[model samples]
Target: MTSGSGVWITLEGGDGSGKTTQSDLLADWLTEAGRTVVRTREPGGSEVGQLIRDIVLHHRGDIAPRAEALLYAADRAHHVATVVRPALARGEVVLQDRYLDSSVAYQGAGRVLDGDEIRNLSLWAAEGALPDLTVLLDLDPESARVRLDAADKPFDRLEAEKTEFHARVRDSYLALAEAEPERFLVLDASASPEAIAAQIRDRVATLVG
Candidate 1:
């Protein structure tokens, strides 16, 4: 059973940064600690989000950056309303694989959108439901590319973007962490999964203390 006051946590990173593995490990740790947890991912949590995700990620046709951003925002709005908020209200610890930071990093930084505009759109979509904590898995772009190359599926639109775009996204995430030191935890992606999970556990324990 879950409590009625959940903690929201988000995991963020570029493709091949191992965010999925880290998020899963952290969720397992929380469950072992007797906490109810909901592990979800952006752009595909809700039914609507899944449809939009297919379009955004797999569509071969070119889409404008702003349009892409808007679709991401729309998926987020549905995710929060139907999934995240409900779980949080029930006090289930929410460990999301990615959230608004993905939009800001991939859309704003990677696409060169106006930062202020992206921020405004995000604020509106999220309705101030910011994560209680955000984990940023920092990795070298080159290393990330290698990992992606070995992945099961072919790259999507955002993942297919050039290395320079990924560099921008990484820089933007780092900058975001700097701006919100209290809520952001920067982890070394080069670390083993166990080591990264340990770091996440330490932070969550401190927060829950």
Candidate 2:
């Protein structure tokens, strides 16, 4: 948990699980409730992070799994130091779309790297910062793929991975939530956006109050 005057909330899940949509709604809800909300995401939250995002997510060639993991850790280090930590110090609610969980799920599980090592790398990079709450938008890979297809956009490197890869990622996320149930609100991502948002708001209300 963060030792600051603010609340830090992170959303985790597989691709096309509506994390972005729910993140937007939660930010709006928090802002309307008179909280100073700082909405951000990993891999691109900072200017330097954006360059790393392009290399890791959109670059045309195969990137070594270890190299990809390091890039994400680098971005995470800078993002937390430059954006997240400062906002929390100011007593703001930081609604982040992803965090260490992404690295663990993608590079660790999907890329078949060691999840513990990946998590430790990120934890060290971020100086051991952890969110107060993590909302896991759990969804089946098949449904996620269908949603991605409907978007009609080019898939990034991770998004273009096989169904088995996504299944592993989902499983890893569930394991993580189970390991830290006190800090996680695991919800079915297949539900209506409004319904999901409502549940998230309820969870956040307790923290913010």
Candidate 3:
């Protein structure tokens, strides 16, 4: 559970899987329902984290897998300490775009590191803070690629990785969900935005009220 008396929800998925769209809709719905919502994303959620994010996501050259993982952990430590915990303490719903799960999926399974080690490191960074709910937008790698290409945006470091890397990430996410069924809500990313948002809202309703 999170550090305070508020809901902490995380949205997770491969890139271009509609997490931002769903997050926006969820934030709007929660705010309309008279809840104090704090919208944040890990790896760039704080000032220090922004710098770390630049290295991990946009650096022109390669970063060692362990070094990359450490950067993410550092950002997680600062972001949670400065941004997430404070919002939770204020009784605000934290609608975050990503969390430690991203590290376990991308750096762990995708990079062939020990998933358990990555998860343990992330837990240490956040002091074992876990989300009240994790909404996983599940999508195939090819579909995600098509979506990304359609957006016509420059690929970030992680996004520019090979399709096989993304496939591993998707599998790892599903495995994590399977291991922690109660904390996860897995939804097909192929669903229409409105439909996905509706499912998310239904699940969130049970958590928030």
Candidate 4:
């Protein structure tokens, strides 16, 4: 919202929480409204991010927790500079899959690091830029696991984590939303996709115009 007529919206939730489905639906709706929408995701949004993503998500080994956090921060710095900021300046609606909130939940809370430290690192990495609106699709880890199992895709590092880890991540996400209710729209991801998307659209409508 600060750069131009552009509005930056990020989606957050556990894996398999219907973020992609909702993003697709929301992007289609925004496109119908004659808005240029940029659909991207953290850890793979840019070329550099893709490589880092592979390392962090797929590499076979343990990356020190701090190192993992720094990798995400690096990706954030590049992504915001190369992808997010320019698009905002061009007045495009940026629909992102994840952002610093993921780092806070996954890296900080899940990894048992200081949530504030992870958040500060991300803010520093992105040069203090934050999304205008963040939509949090809340779902239980067990439900999320069922959805992921139904997908039959290989799990990423975080997705492969235990249910308890994911529960912590969910708690962190909820806490983040509670702390900044004005910037976040928290929804029950267990709802029908159509219902969830409608809610997202209603909130997004306020930001678009």
Q: Using TM-score as the measure, which candidate wins?
A: 4
The regions of model 2 sitting more than 4 angstroms off are 1-3
Candidate 3 off by > 4 Å: none
Q: For residue 135, what is the lDDT in candidate 4?
A: 98
Clashes of each: 2, 0, 0, 0
Quick one: ranking by lDDT, best first? 4, 3, 2, 1
User: Which runs in model 4 stand beyond 4 Å of their true positions?
Assistant: none
Angstrom error of the Cα, residue 23, model 4: value is 0.3
| TM-score, one value per model | 0.95, 0.98, 0.98, 0.99
Candidate scoring better on lDDT of 1 and 3? 3
**RMSD per prediction, one decimal?**
2.1, 0.9, 0.9, 0.7
Native RMSD of candidate 1 (Å): 2.1
Clashes (candidate 4): 0
Task: Give the backbone clash total of model 1.
Answer: 2
- Name the lDDT value of residue 114 in candidate 2: 100
lDDT of 4 by residue, 1-209 (tens): 36488999999999999999999999999999999999999999999999999999999999999999999999999999999999999999999999999999999999999999999999999999999999999999999999999999899899999999999999999999999999999999999999999999999999896
What's the TM for model 2? Answer: 0.98
Candidate 4, lDDT over the whole model: 0.96
Which structure among the candidates has the greatest lDDT?
A: 4
Instruction: Tell me the lDDT of candidate 1.
Output: 0.88
Q: After aligning candidate 2 to the native by TM-score, how far in Å is the CA of 6 from where it should be?
A: 1.0
